[model samples]
Target: METPLTANIKPGRRPPDIKAYRKAGGYRALREAVLKMRPEEVTQTVKDANLKGRGGAGFDAGLKWSFVPMGEEASGPKYVAINADEMEPGTFKDRLLMEGDPHQLIEGAALAAYAIQADVAYIFLRREYHLSARLLRRAIAEAYDSGCLGQGILGSEYSLDMHLHISAGRYMSGEETGMLNAIEGRRANPRAKPPYPQVSGLWGNPTVVNNVETVCNLPHIVNNGADWFRNLSLTAEGGTKIYGASGRVRRPGTWELPMGTPLRELVEEHAGGMQQGYRLRGIIPGGASTEFLTPAHLDVKMDFVSVEAAGSRLGTGTIIVLDDHSCPVGMTLNLEQFFLRESCGWCTPCWGGLQYAVELLTGIEAGAGRMEDLDTLDSLAAMLAPGHTFCALAPGAAEPLGSALRYFREDFERHIRQQRCPWSS
Candidate 1:
């Protein structure tokens, strides 16, 4: 019931300005963090809070920050890059947070930058988010004018500068390494690991790239301490989650609920259940990249570990429902096409394997697929498994395809056997 993230957000109205935000207790955490807590202390508090990244990866936010080299003798000119590229399909939670409360993001970014001892921060946002860009620019100016950012923030020696960089727009650009490349004016192809971004990133300095929502939690985590943040969740993972539902659900929107809220509650209660006359067929329990879940798995908790245990991810905590009227094979084909087009072409498994999967899916949906193509599709999924790819794009693409085959084999068989889509009118 405590929606801390969205409590200050006023729907259908402009976001709070600096004065309004200040009166409402915004940036207090940033003040406390800069004036009192050491940089390492900030990071340790977040780690103790068990705040995991809201991004699909679900890695611990503080754990990721801990990897950055600290101390005066450590790397200089370190950076904190906020990944605001909300490119994942069926995932609009980040956009809502950014559009609804821009300063929260700015304050959070400053806190994150302070935590990592980084003087420079960049917000790598998608070009399509024109409104978010405009509002963030305004907020940044306000923060600077108010002494929250740049040259002795809040009268402390800890000065930080923030930059907003609009991306040209690519799904690959959302990946951390790929985001770094795009930010550097290089092609958005993913960089190889081992020289991981924590040690060497953005002009080859220690840079920490965190998702927008993940950074947004920093203010709350610092304001209330780790225990309060952890207690906000329904499960082991700390804090509330912005859960959303799309497709035939009567009320398709996002809500900030306790972490690990059940999937059934999200779809049936919050989403208003399936639209009249329709029944739930399946669900992609995150964004387009996550594995599909059948109706039987509705009781699964909507958290990282629980969802993973249920054989999907709490990806962006957004659910895309598949109604009885929709065709599973066709849906799979549609998803594959998006993945195929978005492939950065940096790795053959992603570019090459995704194209082949798309073609096979297209053929099957078009009534030309041979039964043997099923075997080939299975092989394609295996080929694009996690270790075979340069990044998560291909592997994430494989999730829905592989899971669709498992849960909707009958649908695929029907399409092939009927030599046409059964649901086609």
Candidate 2:
């Protein structure tokens, strides 16, 4: 219930200006990191706090920061890139944060840049977020004018220049490496790993791409010690998470809850339960990319490990509920269509495979599917799994369809047997 991240956000309102934000202790962490703490010290503090990335991938943020090589042998002109391309379906948490508290992000970016010893930072914001972009621009300018950013921040020798780059608006750009390519004015395709962004990124230098929410925790971790930060969570991880819900929920909104809050609590308590005349059926536990969780698994904790254990993921903490009246096949088909359209067309599996999935799911949704189609769907999903693709795009695209086939097989069969949507009647 201690909503650290959403504390400054007011419903249906723009963020307070720079002076007000400073009054609320906004830039203190940035100043502390730059003036009082060493780069390694800042990173170590975050590491000790067990801070994890909130950008779908639950990677350890501190570990990511520590991966950037240091000393003479390390690469020069390292960069810190903020992943603000919030395009994931059912995920509006980052957009809300950006729109309501742009200064929080700016302060977070400055602290992150200082932690990584990067003089330059870029916030790769989505083009659709015009208001968020304007707010960020104003916040950055205010930071510079107030001496919290640019040339000797807070009278310290350290300096960080922040740049806001509006993306061309591709879903693939949400991928860390793909975001880097987009920032470089190239096609928004995911790059091969092994020499990850931490080693060579953004103009071919050591870079760290952090989510908007992930870095926002930096100031808190610094101001209150690692122990305080760690205790914020009820689970093994540190800090509260912004959990969002949509679809048939009566009160569909985002809430800053403990990291391991129950999926049932999120839906029933936070979302005000399903709408009248709608019974809970299934849930896309994370974003559209995550596997579906049936009512049997509603008690599952909404954390990375627990959700994964339930054959889904806690991606971005955004839940899209499925009502009993809704046809699962149609739902999956809609998601597959999104994947198909968003594919960068770089690889066969993702580009071609997603198209194939779209075709198969569309046919099934339209009552033209056969019994063999289920097997074909399973095969296609396997082909898109982790090692079979260039990036997580294909793997993620496969999750919903694959799981829908498993949990809602009877629904698919009903559609096929009846030669029409079962839920239509």
Candidate 3:
């Protein structure tokens, strides 16, 4: 495959033929797993791979699937929701799986459906991703026509039906529960947990929801074997991720790279270094939601565990560089505005706390904030979490804010004490 853990083909192109997929030994594992191997074997392969979710949570993919009740419990009409809502600020890696190697995603989705014994499946796509939606729909249709998605696949009595649903362009819909609600034609608010999607979802049946990137990795694991998949990354982290870097970079674009690729190598080599005019100051290592990483942290490995060790996540593997000219406070405020506006308003803390945060941040950005507001913002973030009304939205909202205060305290102080933002203003 490619440098990244994932095999990315050119955009909007399918493999030349099913024969091509066959030549690559694609769908062979599906046939083997269905006709010869059992669903338990399939799940065990993924578990052995130690595959982590490419979504923000980084939940172990095998563990999440294991949540599905098996044996007689895995009876008919179960569902697996493919999360294609790639709305995280710096996250667009899933778009590659959708656009480039659609068949890989289809095969992967089929594997998960088989493993979970899902009778039907849905690919919940972001509304703004009209192109991806169209491409996936076409791929789904192709799978059905090719007998890959329909009943008794390769002579096994496993019948599966799949469909695609588009989401309205709202950030909240990316949350797993929210995606389920939206799929059911609800108003897209998060459902209360304890009854997580694995228990009651999509018409009150047990469901398995996985990110697009996570599912796309399945076919490779099945086709190439789990150890090969595990060894894809030189480090223990294994597998490939589509890495994207923007802002102040000479060549700002996405490349499918190995998981343990050093952040410095990505910026300095793959990304062609920072642009000539803007010297690199610090970076919002993932998307804007992640904490900023100073140049001192460049040598850190850019994998989930390593990035987390460096005080940020390998979230969606999107690296947003901040140049010396960019004001950290202004950039952080901009991100806060996004979170504040996108709150689902299902919970009191997020609804009110985020609004209060905006006020405090705006005051600081506009030179009206007092030093005390910094303390207040931190306290507000603490109160807004685990205390929130909805899903991960509010807690995810606090991540960057809390991290910014911790890492870039001086920048926040500059905004407040100097009575002005150090950036353009």
Candidate 4:
């Protein structure tokens, strides 16, 4: 109910063009924002709406924008970057938004750029998203032609330029500083913080980097007042979320549900529950990076605070279901291998520790693991925790592994004791 994000996205239909989009009240928010509202007013509206970033980190969007040095005293040529690189495993929500309603993203990005007084904007998209890239390019052209972008947008004094940059294809490239590096033709290694992208980014300018879904909420937040936007959610987070599900479920897909919708509703109602003959084991209530939750936690609200209170993040709001037929050790090993390969080698904890974790999990799955290996895996998880890494990649990698060990310790023992994976035929 009240799915503002996906109301226009009809299955099997091509995305609406500029004319069609306007006819359906698309850029009205941009028009109102540019012609009537001041840049600070736009930022204040979003802040009042309590819109949180949907790109894994649930940071407040307006609070983040408020960090930018504003007014005539602030520096010039500030930037806004849209993190369209939807590389998170089991997360395809951004791809759907970009391909389904490209103009919505453009309008949202323009609104965000306007709010921050940004002179330029960029969509740092993953290279694998060719279709999304094409759709966005066309949408950008349409916006420019319609005078929604470029010099003196809508004849206002504020001018903005936007570009689409295809990423160099690293999961780290989705990280704020890493995406900034990759956008500048450098290796996608994360930059050390303190002067975060807000104050200094993209050629050392004040750049605001936000996720696709996060920015897409801007147009709606502006079109409807902050109260309307906040009321759309079932919880305090404000607005709806594009919750997705994959693996073993009968209907594995994404849905635009009220924020804080229960995990049980997503799996049992929207995802059509597990396929026949498959009993629920656990669910990674976010992307691959989050911890696992057993069937008992199904009633937990799918919000940032609730999910985190349940001991996992509401990462990407995409649940990856694990069935009874699957092996937890094998699943963890597969996930660890992905994290190991995707690591940028920027830090030893991430690069070296993930490789060790993978090796241990591999041995356990291959029937060569010892009971002591579980202790070593636990050590690796602690070593890879948040403060030890240059970025979040290693910590994210540790979540599923650490939680698997916690929730499914018996399964790891079963593999070791039996000398083989029980689920493997």
What digit string (tens of lDDT, one per residue) describes model 4 on residues 342-370? 99998999999998898889999999999
RMSD of each: 0.7, 1.0, 2.0, 0.8
Could you give candidate 3's per-residue lDDT for residues 246-282 as a string of tens digits? 8989998888777789999989998999888889877
Tens-digit per-residue lDDT, 1-425, candidate 2: 57878888998877988898989988888888777889899999999999889998899999999889876577779899999999999899898889889898988888888888887999999999999899999988998899988899999998888999989888999898899899899999989997889999988899999999998888888989899888988888898898999999999988898889999899999899999999998999779789899999989998888899888999999999999888888899889899999989988989888888888777877778888988999999999888987788889998998898899989989888887787776
Task: Decide which is better by TM-score, 2 or 4.
Answer: 4
Candidate 4: residue 362 lDDT (0-100)? 93
Measured by TM-score, how close is model 3 to the native structure?
0.94
Model 3: which ten-residue window has the lowest total lDDT? 3-12
- Residue 247 CA error for candidate 1 (Å)? 0.7
Clashing pairs in 1: none
Clashing pairs in 4: none
Candidate-wise lDDT, in order: 0.93, 0.89, 0.81, 0.93
TM-score of each: 0.99, 0.98, 0.94, 0.99
Cα error, residue 297 of model 1, in Å, equals 0.5
Instruction: Tell me the tens digit of each residue's lDDT in model 1 across 1-425.
Output: 78888977988999999999999899999999899999999999999999889888999999998989998789789999999999999899999999999999999999999999998999998999999999999999999999999999998889999999999988999998999889889888999897989999999999999988898888999999999989999899999998999999999999999999999999989999999999999999889999999999999999999999999998889999999999999999999999999999989988899999999999999999889999999999999889987789999999999999999999999989999999889
Runs of candidate 1 exceeding 4 Å displacement: none
